[model samples]
Target: MLSLWDSWPLPLETAPPSSCSPPRSSCSARQRSCSCAHSVRPIVPPPATPRASPQYVHNSLGAHAVITNIDVTLRDGGYRNSFNFSPEYALAHARSSVASGFDWVEIGYRKGSSRPELTDGLTAHCDDEYIAAMAREVGPEHIGIMVHPGNLGEHDLDEAWSAGARLLRICFSPSDPRRSLECAQRAVEIGYVVCINVTRISTVAPKRLRRIINAVSGLGVTALYLADSNGSLLPDEVHALVESLISGHELAVGMHAHNHLGLALVNTIRAVDAGATWVDSAVLGMGKGAGNLVAEQWLAYLSQRRAGSDRFDLGSVLELSTRLGESVVEAAPRLDVTDMLLGYFDLSIEHSPRLAEIPDRHAQVRAAGLLAGADS
Candidate 1:
């Protein structure tokens, strides 16, 4: 089969501007040009308005052949509580996830090459000993870990595998994913299932992102994940991106959504509708900023529509959420002004902590807008 990139050039190119500014509604038109130095057209046309109801793919048996559900509670939830979930709590969470039929559990990040002086808690580091213990508790086959290119130490990938991680997700900004691609290549060569996560999907121009995805599709990865790092994307946008990315490729696609806009669930469903195979969630929507798609809620929604959904025992997930709420999380996830601003402008979660420090609400909003311009 031909790779998706085979049909297109590796570099991104923009069409000549016919007008400095096109009408707002028709802005999605490919040849309707803009004079902005940063303007780059989407490789795929914008999808039509999405329906209120979700569309799912069915199996040959005519039943919803469920998508893979990867639980990120321990990994992402770490952002909310400083990675303080104890080994015992982590074990319990993993066990419950297994029983609930989650395909994989991202226990945490691999200890990074940088920030050696910083003292983050267990899940942040996911030391060999810690991962080994978690693997022992909940079978290594279900364990995965995330790593940023900056954080992937020379020995991290091998060590993670030795400690029993079966899958590895390498996350990097879409602006420059070369280093992430390199790390993912190394992990794949080392006998691990690898996924390359292009973070902040909304910030990058579609043509640029398509090139990045095209580059990634050749690296023998298990999947290419679209990370809504800032939670700025709408369901229709998700549908367009996922649909375009998977158009002629045999590679599996996944979605890692942040719920800053209260749209993660809808966005995720849209991605699946457009051909994504894997989707991420946490028990109580626990994570950084406004948190992620709620695992319990997603399973509940799936059970209502997908066949053989009984394997995903919604009660187990709900029980896990309740248990984690009492013992692990400091507070439930909620959207705040800062989180909303982050999503609105397609800024990153790193900006959230600083945005929260501003004493005045108006100042915060103003600062967010300025930051957006600076980033753009």
Candidate 2:
């Protein structure tokens, strides 16, 4: 099957002008009609909107997902951009997100390369000097980096801390909760606000979930997150999970929902109302597959509940979205049948076997579910 681009490329071609185009300054006189000029969508400058420090956010926004998702946008958002964000882009967005009243801005991944060629750019590698410079530019109080299990050892955590990051969020598969928790423990000892994001939350069994929760009960991390990795959950399910986490462990609970079922925003709100203090989202809903919740939408919702239109300068985020919509290569998030199917059946299609043989995504998920059912 053809990829989104290979199958359909016209609109996406227009969406990434700067990345795809030749330099306009060097264009010849006859190049006035160059495809670059035709394809590039002009960004509208945001009006001078007033900004106010939000109340209930404390002096500095603490380690709450509700307040800080700049990191989600920059770090997770890289999936759609091929982790190809420019340093200037990262710096600009960080400044905007911080000024707009965000507590933490996740800069990028501190990942070890499995395939050297795949890791590229400031967003992907998140070099020490590079992110340190970003923290210096935006103030390091809330700058965070995400590390995978086995990606970094104790020594690497020290280096990550010295590079001006105050927060370290570690996410790993639910199948390997012990390894992921170990990384979070080391990060906490290294003196960073650590959040352990457990992927595939919706599918973990009661016994398995209990073991993981028990393991996390005294880890000393800042927060524990249940990532609805395939977006395969309902609002009630989210509430129940949040309640279960609170009852089973001492960790401050958080939720990370994907847009696969078009429920990320609602699930986040439900989780928050159910006593979750943290949540995660991506800018313009940019992330892998169906993408994460939209950061602009999340902040706007927070601002609305509090009575301050300028609380976080949400307009700036919208401006950023418009700017990114004109530059990022990925198409915007939409309801795809297959994605919805994955959510409905509580499976991650991306990890399903025999995917190549299944031409349609919905069918791939169906097959995966059937196989899972048979195995059980």
Q: What is the TM-score of each predicted model, taking all chains together?
A: 0.81, 0.75
Clashing residue pairs, backbone N/CA/C < 3 A, model 2: 65-278, 65-279, 71-106
- Report the Cα lDDT for candidate 2: 0.65
- Best-fitting candidate, measured by lDDT? 1
Q: Output the lDDT of residue 339, model 1.
A: 91
Model 2 lDDT at residue 104: 79
Residue-level lDDT of model 1, residues 1-376, one tens digit each, is 1243344443433222223222323322111111011122212212322212232456323445347779998888887788888888888988889778788899988874134345388888888777777777777777899887776557777777777788898875433455676787888888888887776666556666666666776678888888888888777767766766775555788999999989989888888877788899998899878999999888888888665555577788888989988996464868888898898777888787788899998788788877766665
What residue pairs are clashing in model 1? none
Overlapping backbone residue pairs in candidate 2 total 3
For model 2, the superposed segments whose C-alpha errors exceed 4 Å read 1-70, 112-119, 173-178, 307-310, 349-368, 371-376
Which run of 10 residues does model 2 get worst, by summed lDDT?
29-38
For candidate 2, write residues 31-133 as lDDT tens digits.
1111011111222223433334544432112332333343487777776667887777778878777765667788888863333357666777777776677
| Model 1 misplacement above 4 A | 1-56, 59-66, 113-119, 173-176
Per-residue lDDT for 10 in model 2? Answer: 25
